[model samples]
Target: MNRKSIAVDMDEVLADTFKKIVKTANDICNLSLSEVDVKGNRIWDFINKEQAKELRKAINTPGFFRDLEVIDSAVFAVKELSKHYDIYIATAAMEAPNSFHDKYEWLMEHFPFLDPRYFIFCGNKKVVHADYLIDDTVSQLDAFTGEGILFKANHNENTVTNHIQVDSWNEVLTLFSSLRVV
Candidate 1:
């Protein structure tokens, strides 16, 4: 029997992008920001207009996406899930065209178990064909046709959502495990 498929997002879901973004924003903007400072809000909303503008350019810079730290246990959890479901890396790379290559390279280095053909780089995630989508963005969840699992991120702490929310990879594993049993 064919296994169900899951489309996993790359940014805040599997990658610690906010951590890198905060560091980049601080280095270039000469500001001291921490997870506490940006909690429950977007970095752009938390910082001043000038800082946001600079951050926008800095993030768009080539190599920004190359060395981002992976989310804790993301590799192990995704690998476990892959045993039961076809895993696909779905990223909104069109927003930053420069991230396409870097993100691909990063995935290749980190998630070598996943086939490169499963990597998706696109603007609208609504086009993704899968049984489930694990993402941190509400818009993407809303667009997805299947079950949406919202991976908790600092910016989405207070987000009101009907979809299931997982605070960590362990939670994600537990949730999927339950789904498999059902």
Candidate 2:
């Protein structure tokens, strides 16, 4: 029997990019902006234009993606999911061309169990052909042809959508377990 494929996102889904951004902003601007402050809205909208610009600059800088913490239980969940599905780490790397090397190394370090061949770094996530796509971006989910599972993030806290949503990796594993039975 052929296994169904799952395309998992990198930034907010598997990696704690939002937390890193919050820390970066706090360090650069001496502001005490927490994840709670950015909940239900984009980070760019929560801060001033100058602050946003500075945060954007930090994001664009190389080595920024190198030290991001992996989402809790993400590795174990993905490894468990991989036993039944084809797991692909599909990330929109083109948005930050400077992040490619760091992101690649980060994944290799945290997800050594995953085959490098299954990694996909591209401009458009629509290029990913899989049975399911788990991402934090609503726009990417909207454009996806397969079932889109919204992995909850601070920025997307207030997003109301038709797609299935998972707040944690444990929830993800639970949802996929049911899907796998179908």
Candidate 3:
């Protein structure tokens, strides 16, 4: 089989984005958002819209993304996977054009391994066709027709679904390797 084209989500998959957002929110609002509960393959719940708004504001704070930290296993996993497959960072950015540009630039600066061809900032990811998609949102997974892997998050519930669920980047790498063999 040919090398598969993989589209991976940026937030929880590549960076400690959700955690940072939560931390930022706490710092700004003095409110604690519950930890995400990721079960089986679904998110049991998520931060409410009000909290989400606060998190978004935090992300918009000056130099927020610039100082953001990449997830522990993301860089290594992407480097390893890139040797065998085309890895694309497909992210759902803020609706605002300026915010999107800032986020995209931040990603580019932080992850030099990510090429322009592999960086996509879009409002929706379901339409961006790829052989496999690794994402954190179940709704996005539901929109995709091809293989979708749910990168497990704190509030996920192990609900039966067509998508595969993996907790860590290493497991994601292993899953892809197995798929390549078959």
Candidate 4:
């Protein structure tokens, strides 16, 4: 059997993007929004369109994605999964000009085991070719050609009804490690 390539998302799947963004919003905008306050996958659900604009602008400021914390066990889990499957980090780098390099550096710092060659920086996730695509954004997963693993996030927890959901990195390890790609 051929080695199945797994396309993993960088934001909520591996990095704690939502928490950081929420924290930033709270700190800079003086808005008190909890994880439970998030109503959808995008930021607009938590704040007004005008405030969301400010948040969107804030994403590119500096050290936004770069300083984001890693999801619990994400590094170890991906490293372990790499032994079983070909892992490719498929992140949408269109969010900001700095996101590409920031995310790249972040990956290098956190997942040193993963080769830079496996990193795919792109816009549309639908174009990504893989056997499995694990992401927090349901729209991206919905557009992907592969089997979508919905990594749960603060914004996406109450959402996502189509794909198989994995709440944590351990869950990801368990599912991927136990299953055989056919």
lDDT of 3: 0.72
Q: Give each model's whole-structure lDDT.
A: 0.92, 0.91, 0.72, 0.86
TM-score of 3: 0.80
Q: Which candidate ranks first by lDDT, i.e. highest?
A: 1
Give a tens-digit lDDT track for model 1, residues 1-182. Answer: 77999999999998999999988888888879898898999878767888888888888889999999999999999999999999999999998888888999999999999999999998889999999999999999999999999999999999999999999999999999988943
Off by over 4 Å in 4: 39-42
lDDT, model 1: 0.92
For model 2, the run of ten residues with the poorest summed lDDT: 38-47
How big is the positional error of residue 79 in model 2, measured in Å on the Cα after superposition?
0.3
Which of candidates 2 and 4 is the stronger one according to lDDT?
2
lDDT tens readout by residue for model 2, 92-170: 9998899999999999999999999999998778888999999999899888889999999988888999999999999
What digit string (tens of lDDT, one per residue) describes model 4 on residues 130-155? Answer: 99999988899989998999998877
Cα-based lDDT at residue 60, candidate 1: 85
Q: Model 1: what TM-score?
A: 0.96
| Candidate 4 worst ten-residue window by lDDT | 37-46
Count backbone clashes in candidate 4. Answer: 0
lDDT of 3 by residue, 1-182 (tens): 57788898887778666566556655666755544422232121345677667666666665665556787788888888888888888887754344566567777776678777778778778777888899988888888767889987754555456688898999998898887754
| TM-score, candidate number 2 | 0.95
Cα error of candidate 4 at position 154, Å: 0.9
TM-score of each: 0.96, 0.95, 0.80, 0.91
Top TM-score hit: 1
